[model samples]
Target: MTTTPDITLRSRLTTDCELHLPGDPGYDTARLAWNLAVAQRPAAVALPRTPEEVADVVRAAADAGLRVAPQTTGHGAAALGEQDLDDVVLVKLAALTGATVDPTARTARVLGGTQWQEVVEAAAPYGLTALHGSAPDVGVAGYLLGGGLSFYGRSHGVAVNSVRAAEVVTADGALVRASATENADLFWAVRGGGGNLGVVVALEIDLLPYAEVYAGMLLWDRERAPEVLPAWVEWSRTAPESATTSLRVMSFPPLPELPPFLSGRDLIIIDGAILETDADADAVLAPLRALGPEMDTFARVPAAALTQVHMDPPVPSPAVADHSVLGPLDDEAVATLLAQVGPGTRSGLMFAELRHLGGAFARPAAGGGVLASIAGDYALLCLAMAPTPEAVVAGKAAAFSVVRAMAPWAQASLVPTFAETRVDASRFYGDEEWERLLRIRAEVDPHRVFVANHAL
Candidate 1:
């Protein structure tokens, strides 16, 4: 008698779906994440088409004595780590892609595997927008659970706050509805609580009424960063909440496919979106415009076009990165930050970013999720990619050096989605809140079947 766990699980799963076991034909592709750098070797990868299928897979995994982990696009695979997959069965939701927009209800119902890009396209025709992140390719389920910080974030607050409902498959194979009026406790835990609670199969989320917007990016050469960066900091203080912006310094690789002007160059770029008139947008950006950036693409574009403004790499690639939330940016802190990652520094990071946070983000919602607010005036992120393992090690070290220097002024907490590296869950929540999250986790996931990256 051959005693194989994968074969047993396969026999238990619905026959209509796909399951890739180790050495199976599609196993490699099924386990790949968008980052490409994180090596994921799950015991088995299951593609479930419906919530029923997802629940079946979870229960089957439990029966086979295997932990379950659900991955949509695998954007945060690194944080899941090599150890997390040792005895895990990964549920891939690619086949569950479904998005429906209710223009009358002013909301959208998105399936587990749906990407933000698809939702944005679906809702654009209705003159409405979902609270999506900078990168359109990120999965909707993971983004919302991590307390998503969006371009519209300053104006609308964290994306998780807009979640009206979620359909989840718990560890016991029970399909539960979580909302303010439903399984309310589970609803609060899933929102901004990472994915440890259960597998979210679908979500009903609110949408913004935005037909068009004045939004785009401005770029200045690296040499001018010292002057322009501090100026942006000063300007951000008085900028209206209607406008949201971030400053980033990056060194572009010499890739032929890149634009001639941007290829193989280092530059400082300011990207933002404003829910206002074109003239008002220009007026808000006047001071920074006076700095004479080398490139300016700000204009009145359809809300759907906002996805392209961030210039994120559209395809999967290897990358190493880190993230943090910083206290207020003072003159001295600004100077120190620039000197480390600025033009003349030996930093190997591809991009170093600081997003201005305030306005609606500073206020707390009465019935909001565990992550009520980010607790910092700005959020900082550093990212890098290299071809070789040796280069990756060196590049990451350089990035961390700069991040470490900024630690004194940094907040202990960080958004779950942006928690690229492993840290204690305490860094993401206060002592009491963390304890409450643990109690909730114990209540719903007694066996701890659902494994999530940087999970509680």
Candidate 2:
């Protein structure tokens, strides 16, 4: 049955939080997602400023027989847009932002809607940092819940492992704390289950000890990809756990706002972090540095600066992407990739990247969540700008073309965070782990009141 939220639901929600019903003046703005490409029209949109207000909205939505989808920044909004959300209430947590760093404990507690940059800035003064994604605007709850992959991943493991606790509002509209010692099962599930079981209101995560680190990027004209790609692949196989890096073949459109080096240019770039002494980092980077990059910015810098090393767009962008985890890139694989986006190819993709994986990334955390570790040696991500509906269609096809061409080198598994579309959720976990997640989802959200981007 189609359910239109009744007036009672609106009254209950608006009492404690801002509620935007369909046709309301603020409805359109309230429903806007970070990725403008996704046109999500939920039954209602709620802006909750506090944990209590979050619970109020969740309870009200559930009482009205409407499902609730919790969204923070909406970087993963593409997957949610794939579903029917007419009966869903999008709880936008944009206003629910704050971060507190406990320097002595080396941990940071961030509100549900907090962005990575907020936490990084908060912890930087204490000479600490968190396992954040390349983009500073990504929300903490969603990233960590999806088994975040960071530049520090090779040495510290996936970002989800750093989560010490999460305060979640369950389907019944009760705010409960989940940690190793409290609600252990929920904690395990929330760590990697996305938002299937509940809406995460706050997260207390362990922070990295480094105040400064050697990190930066290297750039070369696209013509060098053939020479650079294979060499980086060979070097990655022997690279130590302390170093994590990614190489991309990128194409930039001519835009006045962009730097002269990047505007209207096709380039190959390598960037990441090396958690080692200055001498040791130089030694490890010597082989790649030998490739003669046109620009080399590697040096010891404030750890907080690592978030900018990837040069992710400083603002929200309309984009489409496809991802696949890979075992290892052989000569055939390298040649195939070159055929798609290398030198003379006119592939309309923004970039096709290969992120080095293994080391700590491959080993399961000692006491981790369902997504303890990634099984692949590398992750392949292809993306394109999608500024228009036609562009979105073309971008998806462009991104998928590269992914499909590289299938021979791809793995059956996937990194949840890198997956831009909804795929086989089971592929993101082991058979036993998948079964466990399903069981937990049943117990915590039996009625399916909570909708997640990648539902279990």
Estimate the Cα RMSD of every predicted model relative to the unseen true structure: 2.3, 1.1
lDDT, residue 31, model 1: 89
Candidate 2 lDDT by residue in tens digits, 231-338 = 999999999999999999999999999999999999999999999999999999999999999999999999999999998988778988999999988999999999
Candidates' C-alpha lDDT: 0.85, 0.92
At residue 318, what lDDT does model 1 achieve? 81
What tens-digit string does per-residue lDDT give for candidate 1 at 1-456?
A: 112355577887654567889889999998898877788888888899999899998988887877888888888877875455756888888779978999999999999999999999999999999889888899999989888888888888888888899999998989999999998889888887777888899999999999888899999999998998899999998999988888999899898999977899999999979877888888999999999988899998999889889988899978878888997889988898898888788588998899888887766667887776667888888888855778668777876887888888898788788777777777887777788888899999898888888766
Error of 1 at 155 (Å): 0.9
Candidate 1 lDDT score relative to the true structure = 0.85
